[model samples]
Target: MNRGIPVRLPIGRGGGGISTIIIIAVLFIGARALGIDPMEILTGSPTTTTTSRTERTAANDEAMQFVSVVLAETEDVWNGVFQAAGVQYQEPRMVVFSGQVQSACGFASAASGPFYCPGDKQVYIDLDFFDELANRFGASGDFAQAYVIAHEVGHHVQNLTGVLPKFNQARQRMNQADANAMSVRVELQADCYAGVWANHTDQKGLLEAGDLDEALNAAFQIGDDTLQKRSQGYVVPESFNHGTSAQRKRWFLKGYQSGDEDSCDTFSGDI
Candidate 1:
């Protein structure tokens, strides 16, 4: 056991099952994590809009496969961790949507960004976020995209571990400002989770130089500072639900440096 939190575990495969997949909890943290809204939709909010099902194209399938491969990596790492901790790992599906789609959470447009709905224990992401990564953020690397998926899947890990529901219940009692603050911790922890994935993947010979930077750049470009400056021409600290660029870089680096889930305790650290 690597003491001091940087535990290195043996590497590992994905499982195939016919178990029922459900959308469980969705977190509205940062713009980068905003692709879906699961609670309002799942908790009795009616779908105000409907449309014919959009067909999944070859490109869409390709994108999903890429996400699946990355997700499989998260599963492998977390599975080992869970078994080491004497627990079962719950698997999640990544629902790739375009333009708009119906989810157990609720109806969401692409503008909602990428979100994980615990209501169904699944992740919803609009592939167009890829455009945001490439064209908008200039983080035009495939691994950067993988980082996003891994981050959302990290939320699924939270759900399985019972952290997310506790956070959601806590947020329900919080004011807007406090809620956003809570959200920042959630987002930062997810980023750390993503970094953990990168570290393990890199150990397996997957991550490359520009790839990690691409992930970091994506984190920076979508920071509240960057988004606020772009949308509102100002930075409002009180309303910053996600941490700053420097904070994101630090937390992500921490995860990479430690590569241990036990090190991810942003909630208790006054982050």
Candidate 2:
């Protein structure tokens, strides 16, 4: 599960408020109510100004190394998978930022969490979110961290396969509730794809004991229902852009057990 460090790009101006992290989920849930495009909120930028903040520390360096290793492992697994299907896998870039970053989709703060920009085919993350995952979400472990990276990479896969663009087109014709439902399917499939990567690593003996549990726990922790209930003490199924805890866990487990990309057909089923 170890690999040499890949290139890491640090891009951030300064730290944002701790409340910014809470706003990420709230924004996702309330986007339609507030007349904001959920898709744009998830992937695009706000007003942005570019400035370099290259401050690095030993802890951040270590985090970068871990991220690089996990990303490389994903590349290796996905390359083999795609090659077997007679398609070439295009590796996506991983940007490690501290507080904020500018992406092809738009500008985002660390509070936005990790996102994959299909526009630039890169994964953006604030490494501090891993700490949030451990402390706030209570999903800790290296494999849980890997699950996050792999989930974003799954978005890249969707982009390459035309899933994202097709969904975007479909959403344009739908109402807010319908569009949010579609988004849930998309996000659930990505979770399944992350599980597919887990299956590959497990096949190669790269996963250790409790690795699967860690990933499953992470999946459950970040489910839209779970997040909403934790944040607002209630659940709104109509506003859920991501799947529920049971659905997320089920889809991820399905992919892990099947280890086949085709098994992640969350769109066809009642996800």
Candidate 3:
């Protein structure tokens, strides 16, 4: 998520339609918001700021393990999907940091939210943002956090599939409004991909009751329109780069129901 700044892309939704019998399985997994922005390679000087480091608690350690497990599951799912298509999936690295961290994309604070940097091929996250997502935005649960990770992993998938590179090239010629519109497509596609991940996870019998609801709620809470309404009392549709709450939920449901990456093509038709 971009927070209030325009620096990086942070990177869900929900439910219904096709019904599948879900089995319960025991597995370890882990893991949002700030609004998402279009994918942009970091430019200009590296961001500089005084950094304050906080002591890591036992909870933070456990959170880190959860993130690792979730990431590994994404790798397993994507690898199988890509291999079936005769392609290899390259997994991106995860960087969990405190306060501020420097990336190939630039320096970012915890307040910048979670973002995937194409330059580094790594997803950067400040764990504190998860706290903000639950407390400030009222979106909580382990699955909610997992949705966020899956969304960033979705961007990594985009980069691998060449969707992101093409968008990066095209956006250069676009005005801010046009680019923002295009960005909504990109971000929503990631949301769809996140849904696809959820589908696979559910199929593996990993989803618990209300897990999908947590993801959908997280999607709704961080939507551009919802965030705007909460922060500034109204929305400027033209500035929305991450899609509306409805659009986010709809696309996510589309992917979850279909469980096919082909269904996540937000660049086509009405989006």
lDDT of each: 0.63, 0.71, 0.72
Error of 3 at 246 (Å): 0.6
lDDT-superior candidate, 2 or 3: 3
RMSD of each: 12.2, 13.0, 9.0
Q: How would you encode candidate 2's per-residue C-alpha lDDT over 1-271 as one tens digit per residue?
A: 0111111211121122212233233433444454444444222223111124524677665555555556666777788899999999887777766678877777777777888877777787787888887878888777777788888889888888988878777877999999989888988899899899989878765666777887788888888889888999999999988788888889889989999999999988477
Q: What is the lDDT of candidate 2?
A: 0.71
Per-model TM-score versus the true fold? 0.78, 0.80, 0.82
Give model 2 RMSD, 1 decimal.
13.0
Cα lDDT of candidate 3 equals 0.72
Candidate with the greatest lDDT versus the true structure: 3
Regions more than 4 Å wrong, model 1: 1-58
lDDT of 1 by residue, 57-112 (tens): 67654554455445555767787778889998886765666687666666777767
Off by over 4 Å in 2: 1-54
Candidate 3 weakest lDDT stretch, 10 residues = 36-45
